[model samples]
Target: MHILRELWTKEIEEPDVKSSYEYVLNLRERLDDTLKIAREKLEKARGRQKHYYDRMAKRRKISVGEKVLVLLPTDSNKLLMHWKGPFEIVTTVGINGYRINMGGKEKTFHANLLKGYIARDQDTSQATTDERPPTSSCAMPAASVTVVEDLEGEHFNDSDCEALPELGGWGSEETVNDLKYGDELTLDQRRQLEERAIMYSSIFSDRPGTVST
Candidate 1:
């Protein structure tokens, strides 16, 4: 009983212990308030950032049936790339979104990732003939195939071969000459064959000379 009384008296001699515990509790509350304030400030900064970003964003207006190019995210080693699509707008999904036809398949995209496509004006006038690429002289006009019915050696079984006709143009002329007595081709047939041969030779030679009919 005497020792317990002496401990109680020693605690009474130290008056600051209770006040020190209360001070630690108060400091903890202040720290919590500081953290809350910091979090609020961070949120405000994020809001401001979003506001600036939206302010700088461009508004795009597009309509159905319009042609547009789409953007795609890709990892590539190439220095330059062509944008993904020249897709057609099928419908509007919302104010800034649309449904597009991607190579026959339907897909959706946002306006921010799409660009309007402008087609070059095509001249419908006769002047366009000048712009027209020169007709490739290398390509021979369609010709009629004169399939000989007589027994022959090394004959063309398929008339699908593109060749100039005896007329110096494109067409096929099939004729069967009565050569039952001999393997002799008629004079008219010979003339026709010669004309076709000359026509094809002229085409291959790339000669600028014209053939007389």
Candidate 2:
């Protein structure tokens, strides 16, 4: 009577019933060997994965009191995010964690979410100087000037210089006549014509009147 299919169906000479204990002991030893092989293979696989990860992973060490930008979500949308802060690192929490001081509040964050911030040095040589001629008290006060209103109800005050929309070179019929170029003109000649059009742009002003001496 075969109680177990795998042990009973084996094509071998019948084992001596007297030595059944020895056969069971041998099977136990074989099972131990199989388990050992499986453990070794698992360990080797883990080691290989660890080696590849270590090669690509950068080891960043941020010290206490150092300024770092923290990765955070934007106010408009949580999914849309950007690096927001140059918060100071207050202390290290644990192995790969850091406590950052955001304003007066302290928050713990992972090392991966933080980046060091480098400040740029100011250039003293490029400092600007005021070169405008001093205005005399006899000059007319700017507030006394009259304000003009366009047809669209938009007001143009004496103080505010509103920027008009660029009409390119085709703004007026006169500009179009001056910028006329033949189709056969070379690229350099066309570029020169464009430069001339830009230089004469002041004449294509949309202002109400011309300046009088």
Candidate 3:
């Protein structure tokens, strides 16, 4: 089943609308069949799943400012996001619906809607060993942030770089000095370089706003 899902999802890339719908339908049917089998097996098996799920109490109320995913209505597909923005609940619009404020706009939806609305944020601490592995991509570094970072950067001394790494043993000291001195910038070249630096830095002496001035 996983191999089939991987092939349908990762291997196939994005199938056309028709294919995706058909594929999702097939997946749900398969999942339903698998669950049915599991349930029947549980009934006959010596061991049983815990009654924790049965003991859980249903929450009767939801309120304002809490973040929640809108459970969508399968009967209607008029809404853009069947599951969308973590909308803040404006107020309880009764058992069938809720008045929600999403992205600065107030909208309402039925409480009996589609999927992803949790009564409260699920406890991350309740995560089991079989839950997803730590995703490396975009995961933040596990380090305390340094608040007083130097903006100008750690000082890099020019004197250390001034001593060339090698003396270029192929040439005498005088010969190398002559070669470097011969390549030194001319006055015009130096002035042009200084102008370029100023231009790149977007710095110039104060002048009247008018170009002619």
* lDDT to native, each model: 0.69, 0.73, 0.57
Query: Looking at candidate 1, what is the lDDT of residue 125?
Result: 59
Shift of residue 36 alpha carbon in model 3, Å: 39
**Residue runs of model 2 more than 4 Å from their true location after superposition:** 1-36, 124-213
lDDT of 1 by residue, 1-213 (tens): 443454546653555765665566678889999999999999999999999999988678898999998887555745554577678999999799899998889998888889999876666555787765433334334433454344444333334234423434423332233112234988887777666765655444422457689
Clashes of 3: 2
Most accurate candidate by lDDT: 2
Candidate 3 per-residue lDDT over residues 1-213, each given as its tens digit: 654666656665565754766677788999999999999898766343434544574544665667677755445565543566577878876675778887778888776552345564356645654464433222223323323333363443444334323332223223111222224889888677666755644233222233433
What TM-score does prediction 3 earn? 0.24
lDDT of 2 by residue, 1-213 (tens): 342444556634456752574577678889999999999999999999999999999888999989999899999999987997789999998789999989899999998898999865445333432333334333232423443455574444444443333233323344434556889999999998888778777665544457769
Weakest 10 consecutive residues, lDDT, candidate 3? 172-181
Q: Could you tell me the TM-score of candidate 1?
A: 0.43
lDDT of candidate 1 at residue 208, scale 0 to 100 = 46
RMSD of 1: 21.3
RMSD of 2: 14.9
